[model samples]
Target chain A: AQSVAQPEDQVNVAEGNPLTVKCTYSVSGNPYLFWYVQYPNRGLQFLLKYITGDNLVKGSYGFEAEFNKSQTSFHLKKPSALVSDSALYFCAVRDRGWPSNTGKLIFGQGTTLQVKP
Target chain B: DAGVTQSPTHLIKTRGQQVTLRCSPKSGHDTVSWYQQALGQGPQFIFQYYEEEERQRGNFPDRFSGHQFPNYSSELNVNALLLGDSALYLCASSPPTGRDTQYFGPGTRLTVL
Candidate 1:
């Protein structure tokens, strides 16, 4: 079985400051990880993903995340926070062990990123 | 090049009633998946449809069902709804192959009283 966890329920940061939201996962096989952001009453918007290759991956709106194999962590980070970046962030995983091309995504509970201006 | 879209942005229904939610996948996408998001929780997968067939499903019960049309549009039908069924229903779509990166719609807010 595979699962994801966003330990922090909420994280606060000031505009222009760096920010981070932690995420961890468990999978029997190779892991396909992703990060998404959601605005009020809106669906999730794709931010970034880690399939393979480089551990660091960059995505929309200046957001990025690093996939750590040893720690089993994939944390979302931003060099500088913006008020517009404030939203609910989620971490997801796809179990490669299940079957190739199976698009089932297991998501974390979610972390509310509150960026104060 | 439109993204995924869902109809009936907001809905209210009583217990034991049935509700149907609609979804149109992103252009060129052939797979549609349904998810249920309870307040303060992550979205849970319901099922997936491809080529007008039920391709995959999650832990949801039989009461939760769906249909995919030839146009790649889909509908989610919930029977004998319970108050616990009140949640945000999300629709996502992806290409038929490749990495299978899914895109989501704004979602339908269903309130079961």
Candidate 2:
């Protein structure tokens, strides 16, 4: 079955410093990778996706992700972080193959991003 | 344009009771998908509705069912709810042209006591 792993439970970054939320995926065929953010008691907000094309995909709130096929990784990155960036981040994957590509997303447990000021 | 929206921001029920959650897709969207988010975990796909039909479903029990209206609104009905059913139910919608990117609603918090 297709799955996503977020390796970290939480990531702490100082304000103005860079931040990285790691994610890895496993799927047959190509992978449709996505990143979402959720504030307290809020729904998942779409950040960005890697369907195809360039290895680096840019997204909302000045965020971006790099899709590495060989490593099967699509890590969310931000050059400089702000305290407002604190929230729960999720990495989701969908296999482009049959039976697995029908709008069903396999998500990682999630990583809590705490941007300390 | 309005994003996806869900009704009854919060709900409390007991075991064996039934609950229905509603969702209004984003403007110009034609597909709606439901997901269950347990505390401290990622959201799990429950099912998806397109053209008022269940186009795809995840590994969930038959006790969970849904319906989609012509206006693109949807509802999730869970019967004989168990304590485990308590979760934050999320609704997502996607445009017909590019259903790849889905936008989610605020979600309804269901607590089974």
Candidate 3:
């Protein structure tokens, strides 16, 4: 069973400071990892994805994720955090195989990022 | 240009009542998927519809049902709703090909008393 884990329940960082949200995944085959951000009362916004590409993937809103196969991690990072970046972050893994290619995503327990101004 | 859209932004129903949530896929999108996002948790896949048929489903019960029209619009119906069913219902759309990134719509918040 493929799954994702967000070890941190919450991460607090000061504005303009570098921020990181940790995520690790377990999958049988090659993993398709994704990062999404959710604001209060709003739908999730796609941030970035890693599907057989460069280890460091950049995404919208100045966010990026480093996919490490050896570490089994895809950690989200930003050079400088903004107050608006304070939101819930989710890490998801897609099950890739014959027939199971339903595009179903197994998500991790979200981590709340708090950017203090 | 319109991203995925869901109707009844917020709904309130009793435990035994039934409710229906509607969704319109993004322009040029042909596949629709439904997910449930409970408080403090990530979204869980409920099912996916393509070609007016259910292509995949999650671990939800039969009490949850859905339909996808020819135009790629969809509806999610829940019967005998339980308090545990209260959550944000999100509808996502993606192209038939690639099928990698799914654009999400503003979710419908369902509250069951």
The whole-model C-alpha lDDT of candidate 2 against the native structure comes to 0.92
Candidate 1 residue-wise lDDT, A5-115, digit = tens: 999999999999999999999998778999988899999999999999999999999999999999999999999999999899999997552234456889999999999
Give one digit per residue, the lDDT tens place, for model 2 in B1-113: 78899999999999999999999999998888899999999999999888898988899999999999999999999999999999999999988876588789999999998
Candidate 2 structure quality by residue, lDDT tens digits, A1-117: 899999999999999999999999999888889999999999999999999999999999999999999999999999999999999999998645222324777899999999998
Shift of residue A14 alpha carbon in model 1, Å? 1.1
C-alpha RMSD for every candidate: 1.3, 1.5, 1.3
> Please, what are the lDDT tens digits per residue for candidate 3 over residues B1-113?
78889999999999999999999998888888899999988999999888898988899999999999999999999999999999999999987566777889999999999
**Global fold similarity of model 1 (TM-score):** 0.97
Winner on lDDT (1 vs 3): 3
Cα lDDT of model 1 by residue, B10-107, tens digit: 99999999999999998888888899999999999998887788878999889999999989999999999999999999999987566457899999
What shift in Å separates residue A5 of candidate 3 from its native position after superposition?
0.2
- Summarize candidate 3's per-residue lDDT along A3-89 as a digit string, tens digits: 999999999999999999999999997899999999999998999999986899999999999999999999999999999999999
* Candidate whose DockQ is highest: 1
Model 1 misplacement above 4 A: A97-99
Give the TM-score of chain A, superposed on the true chain A, for all candidates in the order listed: 0.95, 0.94, 0.95
Clashes of each: 0, 0, 0
All candidates: DockQ? 0.69, 0.63, 0.61
